[model samples]
Target: MANYNPYENMLQTLDLAADTLGIPRNDYEVLRHPEREMNVAIPVQMDDGHVEVFTGYRCQHSSVLGASKGGLRFHPDADENEVRALGAWMTIKNAIAHLPYGGGKGGIKVDPKKLSERELERLTRGFVRKIAPIIGVERDVPAPDVNTNPQIMSWIVDEYSALTGQWTPGIVTGKPLAIGGSLGRNEATGRGCMFTLLSYLEKQGTSIKDLTIAVQGFGNVGSVGALLMHREGAKIVAIGDVHGSLYNANGIDVEKAYEYANSHGRSLEGYEEPGMTRIPNPDLLLLDVDVLYLAALENQVNEANMKEVKAKLILEGANGPLTKDADLYFFEKGIPVLPDVLANGGGVVVSYYEWVQNKAGFYWSEEEVNEKLAKNMKKSFEEVWAMQEEFKVYPRLAAYMVALRRLVEALKIKGYNG
Candidate 1:
């Protein structure tokens, strides 16, 4: 993993896709870097009557399609390089999903868990104020990611509106229901993964009920994905979060586990149940399950641990969870690894819906939102599958091909031929 940098990984993938498509180097070279990057220093007054400074970043990878769109993560590990990589991935993800938007991502270098509620609000508002000049409904929209959530989004919307002196819910996605947030927005990513998996299984004459799944990363994406898959009769044998891992071959009660995690401060530590055994988080990755859903951070499956991955199918629910080396290893070993650009695009897809609803001032019901998401996800899966077969490449490269073709066309149309 020493040689792995998220931004560099994105560039290598981009280069491969462009070369495969025979796109002129000049036509797609701009995509090798972000169009704009904004770093801000946010100073917030703490509840203890002290001010703390935080560094934040918002990188707009591309807006060739339309307004840049992505999520804002709050983690101590947040930095410009990671944000740039995530932003670039968003560009690919949105293109593959066929959304008329580009890619952007923002994050602040602070641990939300260490701050009080009031302090978090202040920090969020300060970050928004600092970055508001570059973000807008028609410029770039931000959403929830990692430690950030709907509540933080609400704060951003309020702060941005206050700054502009107008109600601009369109300035952000993933807001509360009372706001302009679309229904089914929270579960969009997880549900999208489920839909993609089910569609792929059906095409192969297999049923989800017959597969045993182990989900690493029990956060919003992982927990919801595990629950939805479990609801569809999949046996979720193991689940893990930052705290620890839980295993039960007979299929742990997903709902109970979800509830426990939610009520226990979102950690699976000390959770007890009959027939359940605790395991290390890394061990969860080596579990002998039919499916492995990687919903954790990037590079979780690197060269060091690729050989130990026993799951027949690896579905990425997190961005860049598998490094290029690990991805190539899986391809060589004939293990089908679903790339994140296609699998975890549900969040951004629903974000597109939310953006639409915000512009139209008309919101759809949860059923409608989910139906649209499923249709889009299925369509994207078919397209990627076709590309994979046509090019005889892994899904990751195939996805990059699909996205690169779209992006290149947009660039050429915009008179960037040179």
Candidate 2:
């Protein structure tokens, strides 16, 4: 992999996109840095009477468009730099989707799987209590990511509301539907990714059924992405998760894998079928698939493995999956990569819808949510595609340019410079 740091790698792309747009340093220099960063120490009482202190971070990258929006991740590898980069990505993602919001991100350093259910609940509440001062229905909104889910968001809503003595579900998104969660929010990211890919293919006169897809990290994003592609008649040749990966040339039943992971507590360990062969995680990246879906961690497609990636297109289901060097390598190879900002913007789009519904006391049906998502994703893909064609640059850079241009225009309209 590349030796470059994740934050620095993101900066490299940002600088290039800024240069491509010819934006002056004075115009977006502030965008290069976060608006605020809060680091908190969360102490949780374990069932064994042990007090373990965990480090947590909340970074607001920008609020020029509107309130900051992003997700909170619980992982052993969560760090300030990763949180910062992810926060910045949320800004770009929202702008690319044409949402009226900037970007923020939160994370806690813990292996969530190691904690008991009670301990997990306690930790979630503790995080909300610590960040309560800065987050709210109109401030920074937090969603789910990585080890976080709707349950965690429900805890956040309950803690924040109990502290303030009001029922404010808008303070968080991705909650359970029984609460104030939006319909179609769970599958929004993957569905958005597929929609963008489909739009791109349509412009190129290609179809999904003609593609062979290999997906990495079969979590919420990957599993859903593979299933959607399969539904569209694509051949899902390989898939993987945190445990490992599996491949089959004829196609590895995505429906079977999805059911297996669901029943087996979100795992793919014992998945099997005829013609299926288990492969290493990295091997999934090098597979000779038409489209490679990356829904795992960042820096997965770094310099070390860039040369081995044989896919014609890369759909980033994870933020910052390809390092700067790897991104450049793909550009040199003429491989089209739909950057995470545009590829995985579905979650934030629906999150915005949820916020709107909460504010207006009206909700949309699942069909309405999916239809609106498709419309926005199609428009974004077309804009980015046009920028790519006009600038003769990579898709990621083009996407950044599209988002940056919109952000700069918004800043100008708001008279921020004055």
Task: State the lDDT of candidate 2 residue by residue for 116-157, as single tens digits.
Answer: 989999999998999999997778999999989999999999
Regions of candidate 1 where Cα sits further than 4 Å from its true position: none
Residue 309, candidate 1: C-alpha displacement in angstroms:
0.9
lDDT of 2 at 341: 90
RMSD of 1: 0.9
Top model by lDDT, which number?
A: 1
- Determine which window of 10 residues in candidate 2 has minimal summed lDDT: 1-10
- Which candidate tops TM-score? 1
lDDT of 1 by residue, 173-223 (tens): 999999888999999999988998997898889999899999999888998
